[model samples]
Target: MLIIPAENAVNWKRPPWVTLGLIMTCLLVFLFYQGGDSRLLDRAVEQYLDDGLLELEAPVYEDYLSREIRLQGRSDRVYDLQAFQQAREGGEPFWLAVSLLSDPEFYQYMTDNRDLLLAPAQRADWLARRVPIQEELIGRLSAFRFGLVPARLDVYTLVTYQFLHGGWGHIIGNLLFLFLLGYTVEKALGPGRFLLAYLVCGVLSGLVYTGFSLGSQVPLVGASGSISGLMGMYVAIYGLRKIRFFYFIGFYFNYFRAPALALLPVWLGKEIYDYWFAGATGIAYMAHAGGLLAGAGLVWLLGKSWFQVRESFFEPDESALDDRFTTGYAQAMGSLERMEFELARHQFEALRQHYPGRLIVLEHLYQLARLRPDLPRFRELARELMAEAANHHQPERMVAVWQEYLAEGESFTPLEAEDHNRVLFASLRHNDLKAAEKAFERLRQLGNDVLTSEACRLLASEFDKRQMSGRARYYQQLMQA
Candidate 1:
């Protein structure tokens, strides 16, 4: 009794959700262009700041001091305070412009405080202090109904404000996160939705920051606030999904996977720790907090039900059977090719027994049965296979298999001249004259013309070898006839 291993048994199939998830992830990666050292924003900023011609405001000049700055070299003046006020009362872009222009001494003060503004924390605090100006700007813009005149809104601070940042580290850090998280959210929401989410998040984060900070003059830029919203959505939707993360502690490199939900606490904890202990790092803990909350709230309100439906579709089915017979057949063929006859026999037998109506298995079983001619069980199997084959289209293969076994079992050629003729020729070729003579007599009794001629030729050769000239000549004349 042979026992096949359990591992060899047919198993369950992979769920379709696995394939769908892989395709979604791949599309996200392609759209985002993830996995690289990203510095496009930095280069853009550098280009805008480096031009030698513009007499930029002192604060703007000081904010970019010692950094690679590239400027577009375009400047305009606000002659109308009501227009500025009107612009402020308008949309986000207008409000952004009003905040910049509202404080005339803002530029001078920043230039004077350049050293203090070098740190991210100080810069964030400085921007935070300007909350009242930003609020007034927002109020004025609201009063104007977000600049109903398209031209007025187009030229406002909203267009340029997003371009500013606290420091180089702040810009680069935010960009990295944006590139990583933005792409995924973009794929889920589409380009239009992604852009909308980004703008809304930025505006919301700015509102929160401005509300909390009151009356300081500092410029804020970069995409952190918006990207934080994406992160929140990612955590909410893919909470149970595993994400591979890389981190380094001192000189040691570590890699691991954790549920997406688990990362939230870790990120929040780190921000809080850094806020109090790491002074003057210039990071915006409050902005990060505001962005996170805003992102989560927005996505929850608008997309929670959809996310739940998507999650339901993504769940893998564990109870499904693989049901792929071709794989098993391939395995059997591989065993057959390796000359693992016993294994092949067992596989073919199981296939025949379990899938009796399958003609292909019956054919394979017939071939295997022919190999074991000495076994009575094989004879019965071969007869059954032949009977099955007769009912099918091609009976030749089954007939050939049966002949091979029959030939192996019985050798009655000695009594049948026509059948024994081949034996006579073979014996003669090997110089077995006695065996040849016995075969020739059988051919003579049969009176088969072709065999008789062949037998006479052999007899003449034998007579000549024995020096019987008369008998050789007589047989030679018969061969001539």
Candidate 2:
């Protein structure tokens, strides 16, 4: 199931810096830090094997796993290490060696029983060997050091882990949701409170995951937990207000408007369901649920205090604030899409009446008018669009429109002398000799008085430039006549 809010396609207000910063930070971490973690971790593991440090820690890790650490069937993941017990004693497994180092509890046991586990010289060697392995695990690579591990349960890892990711797919999916939900939440809460709330939600989310899998060695990474918190805040901030949402379930998708607060239960239920059914899918559903609840709770608390909900956040942006023009233009475009050219023309005509300066409406009107050149609109629209294009020094488009009009119309529009002159000038300026010839021929048929001196001179000069001396002399004679 996928659900997204159908808002903030473009942010009308101040930029959401906190959200953008989080996204950039996550991207940078993946690119610069986690991008090369694999080779470093691999070399560290190989070095651990070569140094015979596995011989020192593997036995202790097995003994640590043997105790009744956790009885819960689903929770006793420490038993997963039992298979590596033989490898621990007789053979060396790279994965088992990694797991041995990753286990904080076993490391604690190794620390507590350091004297007993190794003799003076042997202990010294083991201590020296542990440095490189630990540095790679918890220092160089963010996965073990910064990533939130249930066994380690470090305080700072909760925030740091959110910035780290597994791979390309992991960071991309998480950041996409962040952008969709983050901007609005940041706007409503403002940057300072939003940042605070975000970190708090992530910290709580980590705690929830840690509580569920206390003995697990796997380290959780990615901003998904915090991103889930943004989701909760999104629905709750709007409260009973209806908001548009786009939802998809497998092959089907649609958009609908519903009360914003109503979606909280739906999101929570989905997360909880996935947590139970798809727990082993490597997705942290519990943390997601926890983040959601935490975010909504934060909003609820903030609401009780001095946090004021900005009702104007939903108002149209500056670019789209002209509601009537925007709406009428939309209707015209919709009609055009449905093959209702007549309706589209009528709508565009109405728009032109209200907004005579809006050339786009006139442009649309001209395009629709072409369907029936027999009507006066074809000539009228062409004249208007061409004249406007000429005045704006946008002669190229007028040349094309002039050629198209010549092909369609039987005669030039009567009494639109200024428009025709503009069209002719634009055509010649655009170097379209074909359109100029057609235009001049039509004017000549209407008799000598209709042709302007400038038109004849331009035609003669253009024909001379093309080395068509016969046509040039003909226009020159017309100029004298």
Candidate 3:
């Protein structure tokens, strides 16, 4: 099962600069810096084997494991070192080599045992060869050098490791989650608070992972923990507000509305469960859980520190746009009521231009056009009004108005070819094929191929809808012509 937020559509006004910057930085570091890790590991492994270190270290590593198990008094059998030799011969010691390299405890063991394991004559050669391998593994690899290692914890690595990724799938998945959660969180917290929360969560997450994986040598990399922090912050900020969530279980997927805070427990439980039952999948689930807790804590603390969440930002923006259009429309209508013809025309014209298909705007503008019937503006308004009314399935009312308009001394002009499609379709729809042909002929007379083609297509569709197959075919041919 997987779940993600489907909150209010993001306001792109601020452009999610920090989130985008973080993503770009991770991508660049992975592409440029982590690319050569395979080659370096290969070279280091060859050096380890060719210098005859694997033969000497395998049994010693077995002994180290045995002693650790004994100290803990666990009855777990030591995984035999026979696989190490077999792995070497089969060309598959990459994981084994990685295991040894990442282990500060094992690295320490090898250094301490060097004198005991090697002869006086061989010590110089062993020392010379092994130092390069140490540098290659612990000092050179991007993860070891920069990523969070529990045994060898450093101040800088907690932050740095969030930027380093292991491979393609790792980086892509992390970045995707980051973008999905980050944009909304950034908008909620504002950039500075968001960045602070992000870093603090990442550091806290690393600390939590350190607590869980104490004495382990594996270097943890990637933004899952920090992104997990964003997840926690996301819910906490929204709190009880019901938000949409996109969830998929097996092949079934859909969106559901739920209180934002309610999901925190679900996410926390998932991480804990995965960490417990999934075995060593190499993912840092503990860190993710820790990040979630840390992020929520940070938001809680901020609330206590006089930081009020901007509640208005979390609202769905559906009505915001509608209100803007309606407000402008209301003011235009108000101007028309006060007998300000010029002001109303200017206002309605702006609204009509912005909202071309708006029926009310066409109705009012068609009425206003009579004030200036001598102008081409009158014909343009007539075309727009009739076409829009036709599309709205109110062609009968507009056809009666067309007759009244003709009675008022307005005549149809064949030279005016613009926006003739819907009018033609309307005429066809009203069963007045003569009117449809007259409009189509006007469109053709102007030699405006674009208008003529669209008019033909509209007529064809209307005819086709009425089961007029021969008429539809004729129009389709005209379209090709």
CA lDDT, candidate 3, residue 257 = 95
Clashes of 1: 29
Each prediction's TM-score versus the true structure: 0.35, 0.59, 0.65
Would you list the clashing residue pairs of candidate 2? none
- lDDT by residue for model 2 (15-111), tens: 8899899999999989987878887778777887888887677766665665534443443444455567756666658978777765555666676
Error of 1 at 63 (Å): 21
Ranking by TM-score: 3, 2, 1
Off by over 4 Å in 1: 1-160, 165-171, 305-481
Q: Please write out the lDDT profile of model 3 over residues 1-481, one tens digit for every residue.
A: 9999978565575698999999999998988888888878778777777777766666677677676668854342234334444665686656666555555667777677778866888778867877878875547889888989898899999999999998899999999999999998888777787787788899999999999989767789989999999999889888898888999999999999999999999999999999877654668999999999988888888855633466656554567867878999999989988989889999988987766657888788878877766667777777666666666788776565555455552553422455445556677778877777766876687788888888888878878988989999999999998
Candidate 2, residue 448: the lDDT equals 53
Question: Which residue pairs show collisions in model 3?
Answer: none
TM-score for model 2? 0.59
